[model samples]
Each structure stands twice: as structure tokens, then as C-alpha cells.
Target: MLNELFTLKGKRALITGSSRGIGRAIAMLYAEAGAHVIIHGSKPSAKLDEALAEARALGASAEAVSADIGDINAVKGLIQAVGDVDILVLNASMQHYQTVPDFDPETFALDVNANLRSCFLLLQGFLPGMQQRRFGRIISIGSVNQWRPGARLAIYASTKAAQFNLVLNCARAYAADGITANSISPGVIDTDRNAEALADPAIVEKLRSLVPARRFGSAMDCAGAALLLASPAGAYINGADIAIDGGMKL
Candidate 1:
């Protein structure tokens, strides 16, 4: 029974933003753990095809899909195209940073629509299927800025904070149906998304200095925790916004 709790044998999992970075890491890891992984991203590309082949090589049934989560119609189509899944890992996110002194409202709004609204729309399309099944795992990738707001990203941080609450709210209502919803809050992960932040040598040093662990985080680092939370091992876990930040929030 204990082993079963962590076992993902015969499960099917859908992961968004899986073409690269954290999303891809989670999808590949899920495949390694015995779940058939379905990868979702913007559109078809050679990179996506490569990732799909890698999963198949690992002996998991995998498919590459494309959709714009920000569009309700596209989200519905994505769901309809995939049919159903036992797990949903929402790892796609949009972020922009600028000193408040020069920030523009239009771009801020775009960040909100992309980072936050997309999740809501996707959930609306996918939640019903999970609720009916009474067994599902939903994991959303969040950011530590939601808890620790700072300069250069106030608007982005606000949207992230809201995402945290949205996840908890959904968990509260959906846990009864055996769907465990949680958020994995990454710290300063070294991904394409944060390329600019890392390009500044001083900025990298300063941020690294702030973390108690004193090291940069990678997608694999977050994946280690995500695997556990995404499996039956985490059935009892709901409404948890766990920070995978190496004590950065602490």
C-alpha cells in the first residue's frame, strides 16, 4: 500500500509548457515514473518533436500538443483534443520585470493575462473532467515573489500572489473529489525565462547571496519535489503552496 501511494503506473498526465524548462522536466520525469506524458506548448517545432521522441524512448506514450491557454476557445480546444488525463501540471507562466519608475500599464496587463488568466481558463476546461473522475492531481507552478515582493516586478508579483490564492481556493473546493491541487513556488531558477536576470553578474551574485542555500536552482531541483507532490504519495496534500526555493522565503 505504501508503495502504491507513490506509484504512477498506468497513469496519464498532461503537462503544459512542456517544450522546455521546468515544464519539460516535469513531463519527462512523470514519464520515467510510469505515467504516459502528454506535452503541451505553443506550436509544433523540431524541439518539441525531439522531446516527444525522448519520452517514447523511455517507454511512455507521449504526444505533443499546441494551444494558447490565454484564449478560452483555444483552451477548450486543447482539452477536447487531449480527451482526459489523470494529472495536470500547469507549469507555463509569463513574466516581465521593469522598475516601477518606467513600467507601462499595458505590459503589466499583458503579464496578468498571460501569467494568471491562462490558468483560470485552462482549469475551467479541465476541472470538470477531473471532478467527474474523482481522482486527479493538479500542480501549478508559482513563484516566490508572490510571498516576497520587491523592486522591478510589482505587477508580476501581484499576479503571482493571486495565482497562489486561486490555487488554494480551487483546492479547498476540489479536494473532496479526490483532486489534490498544489503550487510549486520556484525561487530564482536558471531558465530562459530568467535569462536577463542572470545576465547581470552583480544581480546573480546578489540574488544567490540572499538564498540560504547559496546556489542557483534548476528545473531538476524543482522536479524532485514536483514528482512527489504529483503522485499518489501526495493524495492527502491539498491547498499547499510549497516553496521549492531553498529557504529563500524563509
Candidate 2:
């Protein structure tokens, strides 16, 4: 029955920002494991539909939805679109790279809205259903920056840190209802967005030196942690931050 513990049959999952990258990986894996996956992106696109189609190709029920998650009204609309999900993945986030002196207030607010505030709003919309169902999994994608802050990443780090705390609070608040909340923290994953960051020979070497694995991680790495956490195998793993960082934090 070990394999059955990992099964997601009959479970409905809504994963925000799942059109690409780590979120996409998790969405695909969940569908492959028998979930009815909702692939959510910030806006509608052919790419989003492709992901939905892929999930269906995996022999699972799937659909796609779009909304500006940074906007509370849009987040509400997104919740309505998906209805009640047994698993919620808060993976949509934004970042601004600016030194303290160069930091723009508007950009900072945008980061807060997209990262932290949006999480709160989503919990507001989904938590009641989870509580009533007495079976829910909430997974937020956190960052290593929360523990190891990088230059020009103050706002990003702050939001990530708050996300961790929020997960802990959620775990405490909903444990009695049989709901679990957790975070997955990734480090230097080789994604399209980080391709340039890892392109420079000097930067790549420096980053490699920091990571004991001597290479950047893949989206599938985070997806592995997520799949476990959202499965029955991880029923007792609440309020934990699973780091897919390849020992970068050490």
C-alpha cells in the first residue's frame, strides 16, 4: 500500500503560476498521480492550454484558468473559477531587483501584493472549504532568500520569510481540521528566468562553489518535494519547509 499512499485519485488540485517552471512540473506530476489538476496562470495563453492538454494526455482530468493574482478581486475570481480544491499550491510570485537606495516603493508594493498579500487572500478564499472538508493540503513555494538574503532582494526575502511564518500559522490553525500547510524552498534552480543569471562563467562558478551538489537544481527537484507533501505519505509533515536547494543553504 506504499504506492497507494502517494496516489492522488479523486483529489482536485489548483496550482497557481503553473503554466511553466516548477509550478508546471508539480502540476504535471500531480495529474500523473491521478489528480484532477487545475493549471493556473496569470493570464490566458496558448502555453497554458498546452499544459492543460498535457495533463489530460497523462490520463487525468485537467483544466486551465487565468487571473492577475496580485489583484485581490482577480484572486477572488480565480477561486470561483476553480471552485473547491483539495490541494492548493500558491506558486505565483514577483520579485524586484534593486538596492536599498535604488528601491522603488511601487515595486516593493508589487512584490508584497504578489507574494505575501496574494497568499493571504488565497487562504481566505480556500481555507474555509478546506476546513469544512477536513482534508486539504496547502503548499506555498518559498525561496532560500528567506534564510540567506541576497543583495537587492530585501523585499523578496521579506515576503518569503513571511510566507514561511504564514505556513506555520496555517498549520496550527487548521491541523485540527485535518489540513496541512507547508512550504518548498528552492535554490538556484535552472529555469528559463535564471538562465542568464547562471550563464556568466564567473557567476556560475561562484554559485556552484556554494552548492555542494556543484550544479543548479531542476524544476523537477522541487516537484518531487511537492508531490510528497501533497500526498498521504506526507500527512504528518505539516508546517515544514522542505528545501530543494542542493545544500546551498549550508
Candidate 3:
């Protein structure tokens, strides 16, 4: 019964930015749990193909998709390609570290488009289907930065803060329809995207010291949380931000 509660049999899941890192981990896990997973990447690449192949090898139905979620037209195209998905994981984001004075307006706009606008559009495109079916799971990948902003992360933090609020609002608006929206905030996860930042001994030590866990997290950590939230076990959990940051915010 416990395993059955977490099963995703016959469900379809769309996970963005899934070519690598946390997104990849979630896609793999979802497939293993029985969802037909759609692995999304920014563009067509060998990485996306490999992820699809690997999921199939694990005895899961999977496919690869590509789109620039930052663009409205592209997002529409992506929705058309995906049709309707039972679970939507908004994991694509852009991060530019620049102080307010040094930040470029165009870059800030780009970040907003990617982080906020895309989320809004995807929800709009997918919400109707979910409402009709009376079931949905929307998970946004957030950050600890929303609560603790470091140097030069103004735009990124703002976008993430907005994401959290959006999840709450979505939950309130759709709870009656059996839809749940939530955010998973991760701290310094050891992914290739952060390889350069973690390479410096001083930086690594500084970040590790701040974490109660005293170590960087893994992509699988985020994936584990995602699995619970996207499964039947998490149906009653709505409008909450689950911080998988090794208690960094604490």
C-alpha cells in the first residue's frame, strides 16, 4: 500500500531543463515510478537523446522535447508538442550574478522572461486540461536564495520569490479541482553547473560551513523530494515550499 501510494502508473510528466542535473534526476526517478516522462531541453542535443534512451532502458516510456521556454511562441509550440501532462515541473532558469548598478536591463528582462513569464504561460497552457481531468501536479524548482540573497543575485532572487508566491496562488485557485502546486528549494547542490564555483577550496569551505549538513547536496536529493511531491503520497501537500537545502535556511 505504501508503494502504491507513490506509484505514478499511467501518468504523464513533463520536466523542463531535464538534459542534466536535478531535472535529469527527477525525470529518471519519475519514469522508474511509472510515469511516462517527457524530458525537455533547451535545444536538440545528444544529452536529451541519451536521457530518453536511458529511461527506456529502465523499462519506462519516455521522450525528448526541446523548446525555449522563455519565448511565448516557443512555449505555445512546446505545449502543442506535449499535448497534456499530468505533472509539470518548471525547472528551467537563468542566473546572472550582477549587482544592481552593474546589472544589464536586457539581461534582467531575459531572466524575468525565463523564470517568471515562462512559468505563468506554462500554467495557463496546461491548467485547463488539469481542471477538466480534476488532477494536476505543478512543481517549481526554487532556491534558498529567495530567503537568503547573496551578492549580485537581485534578479534571480526576485524571480524565485515570485515563483514561490505563484505556487501558493495556484494551489489556492486549484485545490478544489484536485490540483496541487508546490516549490522545492535546493541549496548548493553539486551539479556540473556549479562545478566552477565549487572548484575553489575557499568557496567550497565557505558554502559547506554555512550548511547544517556541512556538505553540498546532490541532484538526487532534489529528485527524492520531487518524487514524493509528484506522487499520490503528496496529494494533500499544497502551496508549500519544501526546502531540500540541508537546513541551510535554518
The best candidate in terms of TM-score: 3
* List of clashing residue pairs for candidate 1: none
For each candidate in turn, the TM-score is 0.93, 0.97, 0.98
- Judged by whole-model lDDT over C-alpha atoms, candidate 2 comes out at 0.91
lDDT of 1 by residue, 133-225 (tens): 888888888888898876878877888888878889889988888888899999989887788779999999999988999988899888877
User: Which stretches in model 3 have alpha-carbon errors above 4 Å?
Assistant: none
Q: Which digits, one per residue and each the tens of the lDDT, describe model 2 over residues 123-166? A: 99999999998999999999989988888888899899998899
lDDT of 3 by residue, 105-186 (tens): 8998999999999999999999999999999999999999998876788899999999889989999999999999999999
Residue 17 displacement in candidate 3 (angstroms): 0.6
lDDT, model 3, position 213: 93
Least accurate stretch of 10 residues (summed lDDT) in model 1? 93-102
Model 2 TM-score on a 0 to 1 scale: 0.97
* Ten contiguous residues minimizing lDDT sum, candidate 3: 96-105
